[model samples]
Target chain A: MMRGESETYGSGMNEDKAQRLEAFEAEALGYADQLFRVALRLCRERGRAEDLVQETYLQAWRSFHRFELGTNLRAWLYRILFNVFNSGRRQEKLNLVPVEETISETIAWDPQTPQNIEDEDVLAALERVPRDYQIPVVLADVEDLSYREIADVLDVPIGTVMSRLHRGRKLLRSELTRYAQSAGYQT
Target chain B: MQVIDCRNYRELLDSYLSEELSVETNHAMLRHTEMCQGCRGEMAARRRLRAVLKRACSTDRLGAEAEQRLRDCLRRETAGGVAAIGWGRRLRRLFEVRGLFHLAAAVAVAAVITAGIGAWLYGAFDGPIARPDLALSPALFEQAAGDHEHCGLKFAVLSGPFEMPDSAVNYDPSYAGLEKVVAPAAAGLELRTVHLCGHKGRQFAHLVYAGEGSLISLLVTERDGKALDMDQIPTDDGIAAGMQTARRENLSIGAFQTTRHVVAVVSDLEAEKNRLMAERLATPLTEHLRRFEQQTAMLSRISFIGRR
Candidate 1:
């Protein structure tokens, strides 16, 4: 009877571990794509981006039991990604220059056009903007993050976020114009 | 009412487009855009540029991916009790680094205080005119002759005080020099006298020459309490006239306003050299106005040719 009780106790422990593992796996799978995209923007390389996302997942899994259920799951994931990016940024020691405003000075086009410039023009233009500008612009315009949310993610002051967004938009506008002109499109 | 330059309207355009401008300003921008071709064109262009950027740099898909990867990584690591224990230890260490954290926190606090003070002063003194570009007036062109009578380019005035920071007058800090910046219109017209007041209390004389086919202006600021000398005046012989009824640097002008006064000449100077010359003249005039303001302690003011 004592031997049988020991076997049951051991089996119970194993089942509890299994259930916890299954729950974590499900949550991790749900957040994989979001992690990958943010990592891609920061790293700017697909493989490295994927690896960063994978690392983030690993970190999340290790801390899963501690996570408060029903909290902002997305915000939590973003904070980790931002930390990873911040660490990488510090290591690289990026020194970025502020963008000038001349790029958007010309070309009077209307916003209400049915179909505007092509996608290739835009992608090509975005590649030219510096990483500092690229990150904020993408998060604000593409991801639709508010200025405050962006400040939280980037871990910078809201003013910095606003300035960066302004500078990035100006640079991108200039690049787009050049791209359009080169593509043989008229003013 | 005249239409101001579209360049000055850039800031307001952004605010208007963002829907961040006050209701009054928004109405002003809309009204101005409807009547002014240049402003309308600029607004259209800015909108287009923003749209182009949006389409070019969409990151919705990327954000989603990043979120997913983060969760995955965290889940996998936490599955192992070993990883959980390590993170718990790291958190404890973070708390232990109290001294270093306090130092960093203090610096951040100082920076925020400084920024806040700077922003507050700028807003309070500027009187809701922080950005000239964003101050585009919404009123449709108010003409003496009704809509059918083609009134030539209405003179839109962008005027303000010429305040001088001490640094500008002492040495020339890059920022201090703006104390002497002025936008004095010098096309050419006969007036008893034109009073161009800087924020500090500098004044100048101006004239508008509204010719049948051309609109010319000549502005003379005081030099040591006297009108500018003849050698400083820009005349028709020196300027090249064109069909848009425009001319470039129609005259070469040199005038000495008092130590507190600077003179500016604005004409239809399309030539690069003429524009530079005008800017040089206007910049000094801005300074003269600054000195005048310091002596008098009066706010910047503008006197219109016809009605206020």
Candidate 2:
């Protein structure tokens, strides 16, 4: 019943519109896996991550007209994902005061890189890092986003992204080193 | 090419791995790593760690059922033509004369229908009508009452074994010692539980109390966008004033706003009694929150000056 409008339009017009939507879907849906991976890290729950990804795609579809044809669609989708997540947690934004001071102090003591660590241990260490720092780390290290892109996704200055990444990596390294020591791995 | 030391190499390694450095810096890094075996080994370890993390995280794919659901939802949206007209064009068309008049008429009709339907739904034709002057969102009252009923009274509307405010320091630092602040005013009531809970996407530091065979919830949440309709009420030296009252169903909600938070007292008590309790509970809590606000303001101002 909702598709009644399609019958009203001529075949040529409907075909062209259908082609455009298909093109949009073809381009946008390809990144669902990547988006879901990042969403999982951000939400830390399967159901919430799936919902976040769905909401991101829906929002992206609604605003697809504004998106430039040749720009980075992946970054755009990520921006929308962060926007949805942040808006949902707007109340929590009040507590997001910069913890750079404490984090910077703690990161001064860099641990030696640990060896023979399991993949699970690495993930556990990454999870142990505080969320503010963990985001930049995942964006930069895991997702392979540049500092500029990470900054753009997070809506923070490039310098802030760099510092957060630096600190987050250090925290991860320390966690891994601690894990390695407990598991009797070489450091 | 410029010469580099271990310190520079160590500092730039992360950027180097992320491919953020310029060609010149990359060359310098390569030259240093070629010469310094220690830095090279560190680089290898860091790279290996990055790979392991990526591989571990990549294991979590969108489940097949979820993917199928997403496809179905998208198909429905496409069929419904929801995204055919862009929101910008729709918004622009809203200001057209005919569109504006039609919109106004529709809103008027909708308001009347909503008021009548709402009265019928609540079965409270004589219940407290929201004063137009106090432009608070009606949802705020419903959310507070719903939290009191579902969370405080265990109505099964929200999942439970909720966390205490002490454990919620990661969410909001002010929640760390909130019970101590309200203990003086809540002396008579038996404190049932103090926990951080959320209802309808809004987070609350909910402190439930029991007295006179009734359960009361003292909730504190960030105003976010749910601010009072009136001009800013002056807090005379950290003292809370202007307790706004509203009633929903059988519950009375008396609320006040600080610079950053909305504190409400919701219970089945009479409106006047709820208002009195709100004043008592919110005074100390308001003073406490105002201090946090002032500290935050001063910290930001100091940081602003430092940045300049």
On lDDT, the candidate that comes out on top is 2
Tens-digit lDDT string for candidate 2 (B73-106): 5554444342233222322343334445565655
* Cα lDDT for residue B149, candidate 2: 80
Per-residue alpha-carbon lDDT of candidate 1 for residues B5-99, written as tens digits (9 for 90 to 100): 45546554654665555676677677778778867766777677656666654443435555555444333222322211222233334345647
The residue ranges of model 2 lying beyond 4 angstroms of the native Cα positions read A1-17, A91-107, B82-308
Docking class of 1: incorrect
Tell me the docking grade of candidate 2: incorrect
**Candidate 1 Cα outliers beyond 4 Å, as residue runs:** A1-34, A61-73, A89-116, B1-76, B82-308
